[model samples]
Target chain A: MTAELPLQDASLVQWKPNRDRAKLIQMIVKVISGGFAAVSILTTIGIIGTLIIETAAFFSEVPIWNFLTDAKWTPLFSTQQFGIFVLISATVMIAFLSILVALPLGLLSAICLSEYASPKIRQILKPILEVLAGVPTVVYGFFALLTVTPVLQFIIEQLQIILPFIPDLKIFNALSAALVMGIMITPMVASLSEDAIYAVPQRLRDGAYALGATKRETVTAVVLPASLSGIVASIILAISRAVGETMIVSLAAGANPVLGFNPFNSVMTMTAFIANTVKGEAPHGTTAYFTLYAVGTTLFLMTLALNIFSFWFVRRFREKYD
Target chain B: MDVNEPTGGLEQSPEFVQDLEGRYRLDAIFEFATWAATAIAIGVLAWLLISVLIDGLGTLDWQFITSFPSRKAERAGILPALQGTILLMVVVATFSFPLGVGAAIYLEEFATDNWFTRVVEILIGNLAGVPSIIYGLLGLTVFLRLFSDITQGPTILSGGLTLTLLILPVVIVATRESLRAVPDSTRLAGFALGANRWQVVWSHVLPAAMPGVMTGMILALSRAIGDTATLLVTGAAAFIPFSPDGFLSRYTALPIQIYNWASRPQAEFHNLAASGIIVLMAVLLIMNTTAVVLRNKFQQRS
Candidate 1:
């Protein structure tokens, strides 16, 4: 084409290749990528859609109020009861117990990593601490059932001798579940909190030290406050994890879906209920089967709400720091 | 800088009724407690593995790994369940890896910082936090019902789809990190050579990011392999005799199979569960090592 055209100026007689093939490839790539994005969004929509439909079926069969407030949860027996409060109560109790045990230990571990330990020590210990996360929950369940429970029983037996004045001083109940849940979530809380604490400006620590404050005082007074939001978020995330945990409670916390406040007595959690039902010989579409959906919906909502709250917290905290 | 001089009170008291001996010494107490905490944390790993091995090692053998499950725990082998698990993983990886990586690449390379994209990012992050059980319910309703026409009942395909959703966010995030690591100048240089955006990305970005993508997929797959709750809800049967012939076949993963056997009252079943756990642990260890090695190898090159 250049040769056929008359050259008005010799300097303008240059040739470049057409990019039709490259442009076509670009269009294909764009479509493919756009398709992938669609799939991701669609999948999430599918999840939310499914949960609502099944949960709606569950609510229609068992009234929302009954599911919320009913004390007994015996969907498997002849005398069927559909109260979910027992499950929620147990879940909350175990979660609370776990937080009680985990929060202090997790916080202390964070402090050690961020404030006390040298960088060399921090690098070595962090991954080791995280190894706890790699251990399967079922294994933890076995430990809690076979080992932790017996140890707790021994302690309770001893405590019963001296604390005879205190009724229900035995340990193989809510307390044990909480203790193990805390252990399960400790890695998450500690690692996240450590990151938050470490994110606090070094200048803040320096200023506190410059004022003749001890390292301990500086950490507690300055760094802790500075990283308070992140620390709270970490704790909330840990709580969420504990609440959603299954195997630990299923194995160690026992399967009686009793609504009670006593830590020493056996109780059931929402997760434990679902696991129990799934293990049972219940036919699909039965009222019993629907119970699992309702439990799942509740558990999903609880975790989602917590996660959303934490996300907001982290965002706000980042804005302030940045 | 002014500093305080050392106090003489401790010297005067000598070794008799020292502050460290008689009273609560904060430093010593904290140090001791920290060490105790560290010990407990490490002790968990050791305790779990040791106990599981002690109980499960005797029951675990080549026959046990390859045999079909029976009413009697000792007679049962894990052949069907093992096959099902392998099939499920392959399907999950096949579907999830490409789409997840593509979405990640789009977000990193193409998407602008706008409200819609931001929302997508936020949704993905939130999805990552959702419990595995919720994914199970979704599978029960969506895949099991919507795809019932395809499978007719609960099937391995449903379980794979459910696991895919569970791990999608993870793979996307990992893929995005890898894509981001590619130098911008590399893309620019390709573009300067009159190559279109696709050519630049395909020939330069993806190749450079392959190791990272592979590492992330391995990590995500390892997580899926260990997951039992979602598969359990998605209708993994307790007994799968033969390997899965197709997506519609009823499936059983090692974890669930082990759980079924473990929950039984028989002592032999308990040993079998331990054996199952060991196999699961071995798979996990291999996956973790691969991730480490790939990450390091690519990191050195970059």
Candidate 2:
């Protein structure tokens, strides 16, 4: 028994070292993963730092006031003007127009999918709708340029005969770009809004029904109100996407930067300007090169504001049914 | 009032009956309107697909897939662009999968509740909302300028790195969701057997979460494959007559080539663009289908 006890003690001593090694390995794994996690934070810093550095360089050469207030945006021409409003106005116009097309359609689709569609129908239809979202924006740009633009031109031509006041649609018009962009974002809006609507407790709907409310009345008066924050957040996010959308506007919306709100006119958006500028060579340290960062900074700030607002709105207004 | 009557005296009033009928009719109309909205959305998708097919299907031949860009639209092929896209996907997958999964594992399995973890969570959410194009600018300054020696200038490596950053947030979010779905009981069981944290995660939790992680990875890669603006900003060449041979080789992707072709005024170029769309969509469809299948299979398992 004494000899057996010595052997057991020896085995226990051996196991202790192996366990300690395992503990060390686990600690190393955690540290490595924490390093990987830090990469995301580093990436955020890189984006902001890069934008700020280049933007500061650009602002040094071009006054901040001129960059903000100038009406002309001919950075490529010999006579360069840096009034950013030209691009901003066009960006806002297209974004607003796209939302006009997307919101009602998206909201209605959400209402139908959540309130009316059966589980089976939802299983089929939801993926089909998401397919729209999955299609690349470049493809949407192609469709806008070739299919939607021509269709709009024909419609405008026909309208001209009756309305007489209707202007001829340009080959590269904001209307085609906005319409296509809207279509591209519809699935996003629908999916998010549907999730929000679906999150509304069934008991709420039952309560509305008990009060003699019709299905339409229940959706509008109860479900939509309950999910209002989510719906609005979705819309704001969609708007942010539209503002930053590049390919659709660059290819279909044209490169002419004009400070106006005419969807019929060919207008260059801030994103389009950035895309077009980068496509051509702009030497390093040149103002033209820096404009990319300048415009990019503006874009980042705008989208960031919208994103932060949406996040805040969600946290503020979320209904805790439990 | 008769006890057996379907409607009582109050309900049988003409105005009351009329109002009920009106309400029902409005409900039906509203339902139809919602259906109409959905149909319009679907109709646009169908139209986009059909139109591209009609224009591109004729142009989509073996010769078209094998050839390089040419002055004549009919002679142009997508071989280089296709190769670049595939290689880019490989590079992106190689980097983003490990990094994103590690971050997610750290957040879900290892990290204690702290300010640093909270800050990382918020940053990732914000990063996801940041536009894809902004990542391009980051790549331009960071990869193209700062790390130009390592990346070479405007090479497939740089573009791939940029895309990896762009999709990392998506991968982390997806992975975290999957990891969260894993029950704590599984971890407890592993611990009960004297397994360490790394062993538990590597041997038990990861395998359990693999289906979802795979689905997420495929989706993220698919998004990278379709991306154009980021690559454009990262300097994917407009005309790469030769296929990329290495990471340092200048490259053009399918979407970038499609954009270049679509922007050309000639009708033939538009046809080429449509064909490229077909190829791109086909890839996406395959990826999305795989994701769905993986998710469904695993769902059935657990």
Q: Which candidate leads in DockQ?
A: 2
lDDT agreement of model 1 with the native: 0.80
Q: Give a tens-digit lDDT track for model 2, residues A1-322.
A: 3456653676676754379888898899899999999999999999999999999999999999999888899988899999999999999999999999999889999888998899999888899898999999999999999999999999989998899998888999999999999998899899999999999999999999998888899999999999999999999999999998999999999999998999999999999998998999687899899999999999999999999999899999988799
Task: Give the winner by lDDT.
Answer: 2
TM-score of each: 0.89, 0.95
- lDDT tens digits, residue span A1-322, model 1: 3464555556656645668866877778877887787676776787777767778988888888877677688878888787877888899989998898788778888888777788898888887776677666776776676667778788767888988755553323667767877888888888898888998989889999797566666777898888888899999999998888887787778787788777777788888878777766457688887778878888888998999899888787752645
lDDT of 1 by residue, B42-79 (tens): 67667777988898889889999888888877787888
Each candidate's root-mean-square deviation in Å?
5.4, 3.1
lDDT of 2 at A7: 39
Candidate 1 residue runs with Cα over 4 Å from true position: A1-18, A164-173, A281-284, A317-322, B1-28
Docking class of 2: high
Cα deviation at A90, candidate 2, in Å, is: 0.5
